[model samples]
Target chain A: MNPVVLCTVARMMAPVLLLFSLVLTVRGHDSPGGGFVGGLLATAAFTLLLVAQPEELVRRRPRVDPTRLAITGLLVALGSGLPALFLGRPFLTGLWAQVPLPGGGALKLGTPQLFDAGVYLLVLGTAMAFILGLLHGEEEEAREREG
Target chain B: MTPPLLLTLPLLVCLGSAALAHLCPRRAWPRRGVALAAMLALTAVGLLLLVEVRRQGVLAVQLGEWAAPFGITLVADLLSALLVLIAGVMGLTVVLYSAATLAPELEAGAYYALVLVLVGGVCGGFLTGDLFNLFVWFEVMLGASFVLLALEAKQEQFEATLKYMTLSLVGSAVLLTAVGMLYGVAGTLNMADLATRLPGLERPGLVSTVAVLFLVAFSLKAGAFPLFFWLPASYHTPPVAVTTLFSALLTKVGVYALVRTFTLLFTQDVGLTHTVLLVMGGLTMVTGVLGAVAQYDVRRLLSFHIISQIGYLLAGLGLLTQEALAALIAFLVHYIFAKSALFLVSGATARASGTYDLQQMGNLYRSHPLLAALFFVPALSLAGVPPFSGFFAKLALIRAALRAEHWLIAGTAAGVGLLTLFSMMKIWREAFWKGHPQDPAAKQEAPSSVNVGWGVLGPCAALALVMGVLGLGARPLLELADAAAGQLLEPTGYIQAVLRRPP
Candidate 1:
C-alpha cells in the first residue's frame, strides 16, 4: 500500500488548496467567489486527504464535527439577520456599516454575506457527512465479516 | 411581538428546538422537553395571531424589507391563521401522543427533531404568501414525512417507503416545473401579484395547461381519487403517533394550497379549473368511502376517509360561491379536529387491544364504555350524524352545493355521507359489537381495557371536548367561517393589506 510519491504530493497540495478556498470565501459577497465555492474547495482538499490516508485521517480527532460545524455556521448566519429584525426593518434585511480601512478603501459588511457563509458551511458539512458516513459504514461491515 | 416576529416566531422556535435536539440527541430530557415547550409556546402564538387576523382582516409581513411582489411575504388572513391554529393544536397533540407511545430509542434519536421540523414546514406553508415559498415549505414537509414514514425498517415499511417516497418526489417535481412555468408566464411568484397578472396573459390555453399542472401536483398530495393508492398502503405502516399526525394535517395542507391557488390565481379559468375540481372532488368522496368499507384495519380505514374529507373541502372550493367557500373553511376546521380525534382514538384502541385489525379486537364497548363513547362522538361526527360537528359541516357543504344549483355534486356529497356512516358502523360492529374470537391468533393476552392512563386518554379527550363544543354551539364558528370566506372571496382587501397600496 506504500505510494510515497502520491502521498507526498497530496500532503504538499492540501494546505495550498485550503488557502485558496479561504480566499474564495472572503471575497464571496463583493465578487463571484464566496462561502459555497470556498467550502467546496476545502471539501475537495479534505477529500484528497481522505483518499490518501483513509485510516490515519479518520483516526485523528476532528476538532469540530462536520455536522456541528454546519449547525454552528447556520446559527451564526441566522443570528446575522437578527439585527434588522430588532431594528424594526424585516427579517434578514441586510444592515451595513462602512469602516475606512488603513489601506484607503472602505470595507463594508452585511448579513447577506453571513447567509452565504451559512450556505457554504452547509454544503461542506453535508458533503463531508455523506463521505465519512460511507467510509465508516464500509469499515464496520468489513469488521463484522472478519469477526 | 411585531408582525414579522409574529410570522417567524413559531418557525424559529421549531427550528431552534430541532437544532437543539439534533445537538443533544443522546439527552432525551432536554430535547423532548424543548420540543414540547416549543409547541406550547407556538399554540399561544398561533392563538394570538388568529386574534390579530380576525381584528385586522388580513396581516401581511414583507420579509427583509422588500415590498410585495419583490421579496418574500408572510400573510395570515383568517383562512391561513385558522389553519395555523389547528396545526398548532395538532402539533401539541402529536407530541403528547408520541411521548406516551414512541419507543425510547426513537425518542432519543432524530424523531422529535424531525417532527418539530415537519411542524415548522407545515406552519410555514400555511403562512407564506409567496407561491415559491409554499413550494419550499412543501419540500420541507415531505422530506420529514418521508423519513418518519420509513423509520421502521420492516419489510412492509420498506415497500411502503418506496411507494410513498417515489410518488412524493414526483409531486414535488410537478410542483417545481409548474412554478417555473408560472414564473415564465407572469414573472412574479407572489400570490396576490400572480392573481393580478394571470388575467392579463395573452395565451389562455397555456395558462390552462399550467393550471392543470398545479391541479395534478396539489391533488396528488391531497390524495384525491385515482391517485391515492399510497395513502392506505403506507399510512397504516407507521407507528400510531405518526399515523395520527399524517392523517390529520399533511393532506389538508395540500387541500389548503389548492383552495388558495384556485380561488386566487386560477380564477380566470374557473370554468375549466373549478369544473375539474368539482368532478375530482366527487370521485374522491365516493372512492374514499368505498375504500374505507373494504378495510379491516382501523387506521387504514381512517386513512381512506382522510381522502373523503379532503373531497368535501375541495368541493366547497370548486363551487366558487360565497356560501360554498364558507363551507370549505368550516368543514376544513371541523375535519381537522374530528379526524385527528378519530385517529388518536384508533391509537388508544390499538394500545388497549394490541392490534389495528378490527377483526382481532372485541368487546371494548363492554369493558371501556367511556372510551367507546369517546370514539362514537368523533366517528358519528365524521359520518355526519345529526347534532355533531360533522353533521353541521356536511350539511353546510351540501346546502352550499344546492344553493349553487350543483345538484349532482350535492347528491354525491349526500350519498358519500351515507357511505361514510356505513363505514363508521362497520368499525363499530366489528370492533365493538362482536365478542372476541376464541382462536389464539385472533386475540392477545387481554389487558384490562378499562384501565387507561391519562397520557393516552388526555389528548383524545381534549379533542373530543372541542368537537362537542363545535357540535352543540356551531353559531360562533359559523360566524367565523363567514368572515373567513368574506376575506377569501374579495382578495382586494388582502392584496391592498399585503402590498400597502391604496384601496
Candidate 2:
C-alpha cells in the first residue's frame, strides 16, 4: 500500500492545497469561490495526508479537537457582527476598516471577511470531525468484533 | 429600539448562552446561572417588544440598513409580539422547572443549550416578516427540536424521530417550493410586499393554487386533520419537559403562519379558502377528540387536544371578523397558558407516580390535594368551564360565530367544547377521582408527607392564576385583543409600517 512516490507527491501537494484554499477564501466575496470552496480544499489537503498514512492519521493523538474548532468558528461568526451593533447599526451589518499596508497601499477589511473566515473554520472542522468520527467508529467496531 | 434588534437580541442572548453552555463543563452550575439570566433577558425583551408593538401600532425594521421589500424585515405586529411574550414566559418557567428537577439529566444532555436554541428559533419565526426568512427560522427551530426530541436517542425516540424528521422535512420542502413559486409569480418574498403586489396579479387561479400549496404545507405542521399523522405518533415519546415545550409551541407556530398568510396574502378568494379552513377545522376537531378518547397515554391525549384547539382557531379565522379575531387571540392566550399548565402538571404527576398511563394513575385527589387542585383548575379551564379563561375564550368564539351567522361553525364549536369537556373529565376521573392503583401494601406503608415543592407547583399555580384572571378580568385582554384584531382587519397600518409608507 505504501508507494514512495505517491506519498512524496501527497506531502508536497498538501501545503499547496492549503495555500490555494486560503487564497480562494480571501477572494470569495467579490469572485465566484469563497469560504465554502476553501473549506473543501482544506479538507482535501487533510484527506491527502490521511491517504498517505492512514494508520498514522487514525492512531495519533490529535493536536486539535474538531468540535472545539467548530464551536470557535461559530463564536467568531456570531461575534463578528456584534461590532456593528455597538456602532448603532443593525445586527449583522457589515462594518469596514481601512488598513494601511507596509509599503504604500491600503487594505480593506470588514465583517463580511470575518464572517468568511468563520465559515472556513466551520467547514474545515466539520469535515475533520466526520473523518475522525468514522475512523473511531470503525476502530470500535473492530475491537468489538475481536472481543 | 430598532424592531430588528427585538429579533436579534433574543437570538443573541439565547445563542450566546448556548455557546457558553456548550463550552462549559457538563455539570457546571454557572452555565445554569447564565441560562437563567438569559431566560430572564429574553422575557424582558419579548415583553418590551410586545408593549412597543401595542403602543406603536406596528414596528418593522430591515436588517443591514436595507430598505423594505429588498431586505429581510423583522416585524412586530401585535400577534407576533404577543406570541413571543407567551413563549418567553413559558421558557422561563420551563427552565426554572428543569433547574429544580432535571439539573443532572439536563446538564448531561446539554438540555439548556438546546432549549435556548429552540426558543430563539421560535421567536425568530414569530418575528420574521419575509416568507423565505420564515422558512429559515422554521429550519432553525426544526434543527434544534430534532436534537432535543432525540437527545438521548432512546428506542422510542429513535422510532418517533425517524417519522417526525421525515414528515417535517417534507413540510419544509413544500414550503420552499411554494416560496419559489410565489417569488416567480410576484418577484417578492416580503409579507408586506406580497400583500401589496399579490392582489393585482391577473391570474386569480394561480394565486389560489399557491394559497392551497401554503395551506397544505403549514397544515401539515399544524397537525390539521389529514396531515396530522406525526403528532400522536411521535409527540409522546420524548421526555416530558421536551414534550411540554413542543406541545405548547410547535403547532402553535404553524397556526401563526397559517393565520398570517390566510389573513393577509390569501384573502382574495375568501369563499373558497375560508370554507376550506372551516371544514378542516371541524374535521380536525372531531377526529382529534376522538383520537384523544381512544388513547391511554396522557401526553398523547394532550397532543390530540392540541389539534382540536387548532381547529377552534381555524374556525375563528375562517369567520374573519374583528370579534372573531379577538376571540382567536383570547383563545390563543387561554390555550397557551392552560395547555402548558396541564402538561407541566402531568409531568410533575408522572415524576411522582412514575407512569403516564391513565389506568396506572390514581388517588391523586386523596394523596396530594394541592397538586390535585392545580390539575383541577386547568383541567376545568381546558373544558371551557365558567370562571376560567377557556370559558370566556370559547364564549367569545361562539358569540363571534353567531354574530357572523356562521351557524354551522358555531354548532361545531359548541359541540367541540362539549367534547373537550368530556375528555377533561376523563382525565379527572382516571387520574384523580379513583382509588390508588399501586400495591395495597405499599399504600399502607407509605409515609405521610405531601411533597408539593414550589419548583414543581409554583409555575402551574401561577399559570392557573393567570388563566383565572383572564376569565374573571377579561376586560383588559378583550381590549388588547380587539386592538390586535383591528390591526389584522386593516393590514394597511401593518404594511405601511413595514414598507415605511404613509397609509
Q: Tens digit of lDDT per residue, candidate 1, span B30-77?
A: 778878988898898899998988887788888777889988898999
> Residue pairs in steric clash, candidate 2?
none
For model 1, what is the alpha-carbon lDDT of residue B472? 94
i-RMS for every candidate (Å) is: 1.3, 1.8
True contacts kept of each: 0.54, 0.57
Off by over 4 Å in 2: A1-6, A138-147, B103-106, B438-452, B501-503
Error (Å) of candidate 2 at residue B402 is 0.8
RMSD for each model, in Å, please?
3.0, 3.0
User: What TM-score does candidate 2 reach?
Assistant: 0.94
Error of 2 at B306 (Å): 1.0
Residue ranges of candidate 1 with Cα displaced over 4 Å = A1-3, A99-106, A138-147, B439-450, B501-503
DockQ of structure 2: 0.55
| lDDT (10s digit) by residue, model 2, range B382-483 | 889999999999999999999999898899889988988899888889877776676544444443534768888888888889888988999888888889
Superposed Cα deviation of residue B76, candidate 1 (Å): 1.6
Q: Residue A83 lDDT in model 1?
A: 86
